[model samples]
Target: MATRKAIVVGSGAAGLTAGWRLAQAGWQVELLGPEAQVGGLLAPQPVAGWPCDLGAHRLHAPALQVPAVAELAQRIPLEKRRRRGLVLVGGRSFNYPLRLTDLAQGLGLRGGGELLGSLVHARLSGRHWERQRAPEPQSDIGFGEFVRSRSGEAAYRAFYRPYADKVWGLDPAELSQSCAKQRVSSSAPWQLLWRPQRGEFLHPRGGFGAWMDGLAQLATQSGARVTLCQLSLQHGDLANLDADAVVHTGHLSAALTPDQQLAAQLDHRGLFLLWLVVADGQPGPVDTWYTPEAQFWFGRVSEVGNFLGHPHGRGRVLCVEIPQGRHAADRDFTGDLGELRRQLAQAKILSREAEVSEVVQRFLPAVYPLFRRGWLPRWRLALRHACASGRLWPAGRQGLWLHCNLDHAMASAEDAVRHVASGGASTQWPELAERWSEVRVRD
Candidate 1:
């Protein structure tokens, strides 16, 4: 149906970026996605009067500074703002990211000693911290085990495990080290041991969907064709697609046939976002907070209206994040606010009583890709070989079979464009392989 074109298979951050890059490089690109909305996991869903994001969709400082990501964010109007964060530990609340003063004075002597000792242990394990060639089979070990060995059990249990568990919906032992390498700072020894200055998250003036749609418009306007509801992989339609190269940037399983090993690594999880619209005009303290305590049904909670500017000075919008398990199917936050309210009240975190406005749940089959041990070497090799073969190239979180933030996904597009510009030459696949092989947790 098209000549000398590139096809990208997902509409999320990865697919959109790949399409835009190739289109800008003078290739006619067709972007395919199942959802009508372009931004995949990055897109926002409406809750009450505000946007409730299931993923940590905010652009952190280090990620925001990336030129490509910054360029994308600038497409929409955004405000530079900061919100207070708190961590509830030992029945007390302390400033999150562990401010120096809070750690020194707030945590008291014993907690401070343990935290300092943990930092020291991390520094001592030079191999573990730097992510160097592991003395132990690095890939086979789970993230929790690795952290415990290097950073001490307290740090892993008190801080890393709970926070990561809330986001990934799996125990640290189940997730691979590669899945989280990019998110954490250096594990290097002899480094100044303190929490780095926390980065801020972005909130679009209107909603996250508006920002995603803006990018989608750019891709389509640049001779990039987009199709929705075409979820067949039988290759029957392959005869209809006449393209020099194809960028399979959608979900790995959806874009590629299920016979591939890369597709086999997909990790599915359930997400429940409970939005509480308080009539008293009071919201939660922090923009976002993670809960690992089993007593609480929700893992993390955030206040949207406060995070996004309170333009109208209206009521507050609170979003609670919960992972899906067997009990998730029948869980009702609307009727379960009694538990949430009780927690907040017990902690003295909220003065006024909060009420539930709406509840939203999404069960994602492959929300994240876990780069387990014995997995990356082969998967990476296959993708490299596939790209060289010219018919298949990975895109997005699942496509690449790596864990990447929004910025990294966009960076992937830049790499895809470089490959497309080569015009399907055999030399191009080697070059593409080199580029993909270089992909790390960060850009």
Candidate 2:
């Protein structure tokens, strides 16, 4: 009997996983990506004469939900990188997943005292005391109001407000509850004041994206044919072929159309990355630094040497991530690093002797979905429109438009398999599908 043919588009984690799964399940699958190398943004490109990634990327909290990814990681050269994370506030550092004491410390003696008082006041007011506070008896509010009501205006102004504005590229008030819950959370201030712990951190031996080629090999060995190419639908990236089914693993907005064009265009945020190679040594208290302060344009910085143990032929690499674009039309994708060298020197993260060996600026347009205020309604609407397309199954962060880890991306592909087997009518692949038009959709 002839094999059941399938075509997988975009060779990112999601695409590779989907293609591999479909092939293992007795389907003839072909995987294609925009680059000769797999891994869209996640691919670990060589920077500063060693194997480094776009920024400090890691696989946190393994997805037991997807056995394939979990199994693959175990079999692969994934080393456990146990580095601490800290918050840089007003030039002071504090532990992350933030404990009450740390929060107080980050706020400093004066601001800390006020935050503690506010927490006490909110606690006494009995607003968030209930496990479930019935209903607001009012219309839905936004992230700003949610934080204020749960904690107090003081905490919101001190932390939540600035943090939200800095990291999300939008004011808390302008962000919807759904986006907030998806990103931060809507819990009351007192409840969230305590520390939040993160899961294990994993990185590949060579680099995070290094595993893509291996995955392609594994899938091929398992009977799937993996091909590499610069592909897109409109420009005929895949113009030569037709198959029984097409598994879209790139940006869903590319395949999802006319009806959702507005939402698709408006919902995603472009990502800007700046990678600097430090000759001296590791900097900062942790492997990753999260600063929401106005002074630091980049929200987070990750030291690669701390994770991979300072590879040969290069100095320690520091990857700084600016949450949004500086200007609307900045033309630097991977350009000069001299401009930001002063900022790094001032912060002391980079030493006076440390020379900026190389700078790689990657501007990924629409890499993240803007989980903005009231974005839930339009997101659901858009997903519904895309899912109704039937043949095209969108998977992964870019495809699903959700903020997720590598595990979620792999699991999303697992879900996509169920949809492929059922010819897109499966209850799984698209998130809001099963609950479509139900109370959940409206919610």
Candidate 3:
């Protein structure tokens, strides 16, 4: 009857959740993170008196029912709000979770007709059924093919193609079908034809970081140790830690051997979060704006005030996500401010006369996993190598390379803890890992 010791790596939501759960289960837990604070992307920092996240992050309504997520909700007050956003396409503003009427009106006669015709043609030609009956392995089918099969060429080119290119900095043809399957919610053209309705989402009273801090506090209260220190498997750094189980919630590369790392060829897309304080700015009711066009350097822009339900005031902060492709040389992003402002004005997100009071730039490496074609096999191989010792458990978005939401990370943490509780059975984890692989990324 000895107390079990668990080491949880990468103090993000998954690591913190695993630490909390293990501690509550009467196990000794040590949660470690490279950053001083927890929450990873969910961490919020103050920008011009307004709390802004690294990016626009929110807990979808579906995650509320999760036991761990529900526990966090109890500790921190979560406000349920209807999702509001716009997608700017071809110089037209379309309500996000886009509506058919809006598209028809925005595209006008010729464009709308082509779009409608394409959809009809796709259906009549049974392209959707053909896609279902595609003989090629899922890995062989590219993102471009998957989208075109379901939504037709018009929709693919109009939105999916350009947006995927802008966000991931990869040709849609180079991206895996799994990427489309996980990230694109509406696979069928008919799905977009439905009447547009706002969806509900959850957010903490202060910011998402509050929830992470709360989880860490709860974990500590339950007798878990939290540390702000870096750990590396490549250098054999984790070899000395005396733990019955190690839950790794960082990038898979971090846990791999140097040779395995080279073989895996794993890569990530970095982000430049340009936080701007606009004086006398009116963001309207929109929470986020998606800009797929190449003219806009930033892919997505979010109004922090809208998330917290704060009214238009003297100033508001906007977080703009600019994807810095896989191997871009690091340089000063401030130089791009003028172009950003001009584009923001052009998009009508900001008034031309509005003065940008202050601008802060934060560069986050590895914001997203680059899901290149045939990446699954490599990812699985890396995961297997990382967990070969049977002591390490990879969990969370980064750990699993899953483009999932915060709730999914917490749920994965729960599953990891369950596996550890079962005496780290070798047979149990592969099934769990397979299940994790199938988790669809929610936008």
Measured with C-alpha atoms, the lDDT of residue 233 in candidate 2 is 61
Name the candidate that leads on TM-score: 3
Least accurate 10 contiguous residues by lDDT in model 2: 434-443
Model 3 C-alpha lDDT per residue in residues 237-303, reported as the tens digit of each score? 5545678788888887887778988888788778888888877776678899988788888888998
User: Higher TM-score: candidate 1 or 2?
Assistant: 2
Model 2 TM-score (2 dp): 0.85
Task: Give a tens-digit lDDT track for model 2, residues 78-103.
Answer: 77777587777667776665566677
lDDT of 3: 0.79
Model 1 scores worst on lDDT over the 10 consecutive residues at: 184-193
Better of 1 and 3 by TM-score: 3
Clashes of 3: 0
TM-score of each: 0.82, 0.85, 0.94
Q: List the residue pairs that clash in candidate 3.
A: none
Give the clashing pairs for model 2. 44-209, 150-189, 175-373, 176-373, 333-361, 334-361
Residue 180 shift from truth in candidate 2, angstroms: 2.0
Q: Which numbered prediction scores highest in lDDT against the true structure? A: 3
- State each model's CA lDDT, in order: 0.60, 0.65, 0.79
